[model samples]
Target chain A: MRNLKMTIQYDGGRYKGWQKQKEGESTIQWKIENVLKRMTGEEIQVIGCGRTDAGVHAENYIANFHTNSELSVETMMDYLYEFLPEDIVVKSIKDTTERFHARYNAKGKTYVYRINNGEVRNVFNRKYTYHTSVKLNLDAMREGAKYLVGTHDFQSFTSQKPKTKSTERHIKYININKTGDMIEIEVDGNGFLWNMVRIIVGTLLEVGMGHMKPSDVGRILEEKKRSESGPIAQAKGLCLKEVHY
Target chain B: MRNLKMTIQYDGGRYKGWQKQKEGESTIQWKIENVLKRMTGEEIQVIGCGRTDAGVHAENYIANFHTNSELSVETMMDYLYEFLPEDIVVKSIKDTTERFHARYNAKGKTYVYRINNGEVRNVFNRKYTYHTSVKLNLDAMREGAKYLVGTHDFQSFTSQKPKTKSTERHIKYININKTGDMIEIEVDGNGFLWNMVRIIVGTLLEVGMGHMKPSDVGRILEEKKRSESGPIAQAKGLCLKEVHY
Candidate 1:
């Protein structure tokens, strides 16, 4: 048995995120599995660090899986890049310890959400950015994000989905950076719940746009209710920046 | 007659190019025309500075059209932005002199082509860049480009499809800048022939890769033959940077 560590990147626009689903429904994992099965003539399970929502994207996402086939890690990546859709890219593959797991043993994760704060919509970048067309107070959003740092109950931020039994998580850090026409929110955390980042973003956007007080984020966290937070932002602006282990 | 001056931008990945074409299917002009017709209930003819090829992007393009409608420039641009597909944007519009022409009155046009010179493909930016994993000899390419600046007969770089009466054109500036994993080629020309920029990129790429000598570009120009130049670069990497009139 060989442990293969793959650094994957994908445009999740046409995918049902990263999880495997029905044959007709598209997924990043299903596409990878299909391509690997075709290349090695053996069924291979491609595990991802975490699942992204549909229309979300990734730049450098890490995933690992075990295989008994003779295909070398480098060869597998080369073949996968050639066969996969242009939107998906397998950047690198390497041999790892047999005990390596993409998710269970992860230490920290980082994500970046882009907000287009420009008055005009960027036609080419519409698919990847959240168009606000509003003048945002970045300092207020940054101040609010500081309250989200450190380990705490993120129940107000996470969705009450059936799959998630618990809402507690630790967000190590959240940094908001502003460029000319865009604002980038970078969050580092030990773990995140369903829609946690988007909710945080939505909440922060409200604070930035003066809809909510900057200190209201602390109250939302303490309330431990999903309805207390602002609306969840669109998934398209969210990106799985990195997975760490 | 009200002359409307419009500033436009588009991601040319899906269309057949800027010019109105009947054989190769839909073009950007046709789509804009359809939207304009829908808005004003009248046929409007728009003239652009130059025809950008299929898959070539534009950040700022100029166009002019005559209309008898009472729509304000801001209202027209707003409506166009909403009406046009997510890939195209009408950034600004203004009423201009009746003598204004997008093509004939143009003083200079700037074009940019991006080459992603990296071992790994960027998944998020796949559609906007050309991936060339090989290292390039920047000095050699720059040397070749120096000869391209100034007035010259660009017949060798022009494609021979529908014969144009003249192929000679003046290029005002040629800038080759390489940053990290991308190389940006910027050219300002009085006017470019069909496929001229793409072919020049191909020739410069060959020079950078040591496939063709840097001095060979001068010979190709002197030969005045399309076959003498390198293969035309893919249209996806090229963009109309700006049109100045």
Candidate 2:
């Protein structure tokens, strides 16, 4: 079997996350696999690095699949490009070692969340940004995010109750920046739990809006309770920016 | 009557254009006017700077309306902001001189056309840019654009056949710039005829693609015939960037 690694970019607004669902539900993986079936006449089991919630976008999502087709990479790329939807783009594809699995080899990830903290929204970027009229306190949000960095058991940050799986994660950095009325929060980490990034963002937003103190973040993390965290932020503002192997 | 000058922005992907058409047709004007009627309980007529074609977006389009209601600008702004669709945003509103007309008083306007000149399109900006896999020669397009700048009777660069009306227009500048894979063409002019900017862009694209020589632009203008120009570019890539008073 020939292992093929691919770099993908997609606007996940109309998808049911990355994984394939029952039959009719649309997904990024299902879309590519469907296109590959037509091109190779073989059922291509494409593996994604990770799953992204509905309405989340991605810039450089990594994936891999094993195939027996002897077609050139360029020919397969051209065929896939012609068949895939406009919102989903296959940036590049190449041969890879058999053991270079997409999911297992992923070492780190970076995500970006955009907030339109302006009274007048940006019409051009309406879909990609979450609009909030309330003025956000930047310094406070930055201070709050600092508490979430570094390795710790982040049980308070996720939606699921991890009974057996360890919830410990090492967050490298959390950077909050504002340009014009757009505020972008970039988070890089070794791993993330279900709804973890959104919950952390929500807690920071609470601090920014003066509802919670920056010290509350440390308290919430220590509590190890899901109810201690803030509400989950909207999925539309979140984007999978990078995946490092 | 208070002559209110308002700045508006919209993603014109969904609308037919800026003007109100039939009773059921949706347009920027119709959307705003409908909101005003609900707010003031009066039939309000909103005048736009000019008409934009279908799927054309705007960033800082100027418009005006005469209202009899003694409502504060902020109150009206809030009502409009709350009621208008998310794709349309009323940026600002203020009382202007009674004689200040949106269409007639305009001194000049600036437009921007974006081209995604890359093998793989930017998924986030798919709606805002025109994607062409053909590698464009930037220097050639710039060279062709120079011939169209400055004062000239652009008879061949418009869709409408002007008989007695003056087709003379003073084009201030036409700048072509490339950053990463995005190429932006900015055109500043005193006024434009129907589809003049679109036709001009189409001709420049033809030059960039090596279909026509750069000098052909000069000859096309000299011919003063509609058939001499290239095809009209797509409306989605065009945006009304600014309107000068």
Candidate 3:
């Protein structure tokens, strides 16, 4: 048996998400597994580093799978590239140790959300950015992002109540930058809860739009109530930029 | 009647082309005319600055139409924005003189062609760039581009025989630039013949790939035979960047 580690990139616009489903819906994982099954002539299951919500893109997603196929890594990479859909690409493939686990071995993750704050939308980039003509207060958004950094329980930022043993997670950094008419929010963390990044972006946007105050994030986090946070930002603007091991 | 001048942007991946077709094919002009007809209750003919081939995009295409409607420019802009498809956008709209014509009054035009010279294609920008894995010689391409500048009869560069009174056209400049793994060729000229820009790109790419020498471009231009030039590049990589008046 050989363990294969792969770096993947996908445009998740047409996919349900990264995970396989019982309904057999189209997903990035399902697509790759289907290709692998055909190539290896065996049922193949791929474990991803983490799950991304529907319509979220990824530039450097990591995954690993165990297979008994005798094909070389170069041959497998070439075959996968030839068979996979244009939106999903296997960037690199390599043989790894049997002990390697994609999810458990992941030490950190980074996500970036894009907002097109221009009066006129960019037609070419419409799929990847969320459009908003409303003027955003960059300074206020930056101030609000600071509160979300450091280790804390991000219970209020997720959709459901925490099922894990603890909701405590360390957010290493939060950077807000405006380039031309596009504003990008980049967040790095050890782990993220369901919809946590999107919800945090929503809360920061609310503060930028003057609907909420920067200090409100602290109170919301302390309360640990989902209703206290801002509405969940659209999934289309969010992209899993990197998975660091 | 007021002559309205508008700047348009579109992702032409799905459209047939910029010109309206008699066979009821979907075109950018047809879509805009349909919206104008419904809004003004009159047969509206929109004349664009030039025709773009199928799958070719535009960033600052100019167009003009005479409308009898009493709607303000702001209202028309809003209506167009609401009615047009997500891939098309009206960047700006203003009133122009009666003597103005979209095709005839244009002084110069700028076009840009992008090449993804990377090992892996960028899925997010797949529709907008042409991918080639071959390492390109930028200095060679730039050397070839210099020969195409200034006044020249570029009959060999165009696919169709010149129907105009003169085949002479002046190329103002050609700028070849590389940003990361993307190569951009920006050309500015008084006017372009059909398929002229694509053919020029094809020829330059040949030089970049070391198939042709840089000085061969001058000889190809002097021959004035279309067969002497390289094949026309794909339309997806070409975009009308600006229309200068």
- Which candidate comes out best when scored by TM-score? 2
* Model 3 lDDT tens row, A91-154: 8999999999999999999999999999988999999999999999999889888888999989
Residue ranges of candidate 3 with Cα displaced over 4 Å: A162-165, B162-165
The TM-score, computed over Cα atoms with residue i paired to residue i, of candidate 1 is: 0.96
> A29 in model 2: Cα distance from truth in Å?
0.8
DockQ of each: 0.79, 0.87, 0.82
State the fnat of model 1: 0.85
CA displacement after TM-score superposition, residue B98 of candidate 2 (Å): 0.9
lDDT of each: 0.87, 0.93, 0.93
Q: Which candidate is the best by DockQ?
A: 2
**Which candidate order results from sorting by DockQ in descending order?**
2, 3, 1
Between the candidate structures 2 and 3, which one is better when assessed by DockQ?
2
Clashing pairs in 3: none
The digit string of per-residue lDDT tens for model 2 on B1-39 reads 899999999999999899966786889999999999999
DockQ of 1: 0.79
Off by over 4 Å in 2: none
Native-interface RMSD of candidate 3: 0.7
- Expressed as tens digits, the lDDT of each residue in B23-118 for candidate 1 is 447788888888888888789988988788988999998998998999887788778988888898888888999999999999889999999999
